[model samples]
Target: MKAILKQHEEHKRELEQLNDHWENSARYLEYTKQELEERLYHAEESAILIKEELDEISIQKEIEIQRLKDEIKDLRQEISFLSSSQVNNHRVKELEDALNKAMREQMEFKEKLRIAKEQSEGGNGEVTEVTTTVRVIVKVRPFLDSDPAGPQCLMCNDTEVQIESKKVGSAKCFMFEKVIGPDDSIDELFMDLESNIVHAANGGNSCILAYGQTGSGKTYTMNGVISRSLNKLKQRFDCESVMISLQIIEIYNEQVKNLLTNDPLSRDWKDILNLSEIQLGNNWVSKAQDLIKKSCHKRQTKSTDSN
Candidate 1:
């Protein structure tokens, strides 16, 4: 019995040790679980922080990319604008060159035509006498109040006129039979033409034609010439022996009309009457002057760009 009791006590002690060991093991397990849970929580927080940092970095990168794109777009636009400007400048240069070439060609052609005409005239089978049949006179008008203000491009002397070229940067000279400057008087011009044209009218058909741009004093000069010429004719010829006839006509818009006709509006052939001779007298001269004035009033006039 004693042995059996001792064995039983030993068994009971073994069971208590086992129970204590189990309790210690369970406590250790609980502590380990708590530590593991805390570590997992910390890891989760770190992951969230990393995600936020990544998002911020991505946003900054996107902003930088957008800024670069805008800069590139602006650069392209500037390049395009510069290219267009260059093209426009090149086109304008080409047009100017073409215009200059055309002007040069036209001048050359005109010179050739003049030479050809002279050659043809010389070759004609006739007694070719060097006579001043045609005379070209250049008249430079004085500046008027209505004219635009700028540097004078034309320079003139007694027999030569020079024009400064803007493109060539040189002066081009032209020779004429007479070059009437702004300072030259109407009397001088009349004196120049009187011996050649007015005196020749007595023997042959002679005409004094005034050709010029609008507002170049053509009418004023012609009126003065006519008055002077009539007085000169009266002085040269005896009134009884010489018979003077007057006919006045006007050409406007490519149509001819007799200014001295009974009907001013009539364009018929009958309206042009045959010129009759009358004794050259003061009465006839006064009538002629009056007729000229009437004809001048009937002339067609319009404003031009040059005027």
Candidate 2:
């Protein structure tokens, strides 16, 4: 019985120690649980804050991406605009150069045309002279205040005329030896006719007769030519041996009269008409100027001139 009591006491003591160790383990487990719970709560709070930060970052990234896209789009538009402007500028420069080239070409053509025209006219004038023996010349009179103007019917160049023929339905251009306009000087006409008069005076039977409509300036031309030619003859000739003469006659209504009153006339009209006895030897050249003036004045007062 004593040995069993001692063994029971030893067992009881061992049980108490085991219970104390169990209690210490329980307390340690409870403290570990509380620390774990606290750590988990802190972890949860940290996760929430991190999630919020991540969400904000995502939103900012999206905003930044959108902003970058907009910037790219604007840059593209600017590039497109610059490209178009460059192309247009190139085209404008090309057009300006083309216009300048065309203008230069046109000027060159005009210069060539002018030169060709001058050469052609000179050639035509020479060729036309060889074509005809009977050369028709024309002179245009100036318009008088009292004269009435017709339609623009007359058309002529320097050496040619396109006049409607007298017969209807005919159109032909008449190439003339010379065409004188109203602007031509009277000295020009006298210069042309003087050669013939001088030829005749040097011993060729040349006669000049001018007849036209009444008051058509024929008398004026003849008078001017005669006066100018006489002056040339006086200057050319030494008057010692070259005796020039003149005879004048007038017939008024078929009544014969003498214009040179200083000389007597024979009764026979036949004698006066005959050129055989006529001599330019000693009659009117000595008293030329006074005789001309007298004769012209008398012709105006009386119907005396027959030739």
Candidate 3:
């Protein structure tokens, strides 16, 4: 009976021990489950935060895209306005050109009538020959930056020029009233021509003509001559007693255009001149220079083979 009871006690203790072990395992599994739940909760919160950030970023991108679209629309409108303005400006320029042409034609007609009336008054159909001394001045232009490198072909002296001839193997000499070298100054040229040309104009009609190749400094020389001649005349004549009248005309493409009337920006030319007298002073000279500049600006130019 004691052995049976001891065996029963041993079985009971083993059952107690198993129960204790099972309880400990269950407690540990419960702790692990809690930890997993906490982790899952924190992950869900992070996902929500990230989704919110993405939504904010998307909104900002939309705003930026709309702003850019607005700017592009404004720029397109501005370009359209500028295009219309350019067209209007072109049409205005065409009208101004036409007005200038009409005025030039009217002036030319009046000049022709005046000339015809003078011829009628003279009444002598026979033309009178007036002997006037003719002087020819030759000027050699200096080498420019655009000029090609080559050997000198012409040697110039005070009153003559010698050109080298490769075919003849000789230098051909030509005599002129005055031969101006490339090194000569505009003042030197003006001085040479003044005594014969400018002074003679006071007594009778005198003409100074410039003819040359495209880039041979004809316009430059003529401008200098005009300025110097005006100053010399101002000094020679009494401003109070003698009045000087000036007229400038340009011929281009077989058409004669009055430069004084062509420039729209300049003041009325009649204000500078009167029927009975012309105002001559520093003010007049300044006005004249300004008018000349405006008129020259209106003169058309085209590129040539030599230039």
Top-scoring candidate (lDDT): 1
Q: Clash number for model 2?
A: 0
Checking candidate 3 for backbone clashes, the offending pairs are none
Question: Candidate 2, residue 214: CA error in Å?
Answer: 0.7
Residue 73 shift from truth in candidate 3, angstroms: 66
Tens-digit lDDT track of model 2 for 1-307? 9999999999999999999999999999999999999999999898667656655654555455344334533443454465667766665565555544543443344334333333434332111112233334565554443544432445665577665645554667777567644434455555445556566567655454554555446667667767876776676577556777665576655555566554344456676655323344443344575676676665533232322
Q: Estimate each model's TM-score.
A: 0.51, 0.42, 0.48
Clashes of each: 0, 0, 0
Residues 176-247, model 1: lDDT tens digits:
998866544565566457655543644765678999778878999899989887777666666556557777
Which scores greater on lDDT, model 1 or model 3? 1
Q: Is candidate 1 or candidate 2 better by TM-score?
A: 1
Candidate 2 all-Cα RMSD: 50.5
Which pairs of residues clash in candidate 1, taking residues 3 or more apart in a chain or in different chains?
none
- What lDDT does the true structure give each of the candidates? 0.64, 0.56, 0.64
Which 10 successive residues of model 1 have the least lDDT summed? Answer: 121-130
Q: What is candidate 2's local distance difference test score?
A: 0.56
What 10-residue stretch in candidate 2 is worst by lDDT? 124-133
TM-score of predicted structure 3: 0.48
Query: In candidate 1, how many Å is residue 296 off?
Result: 1.1
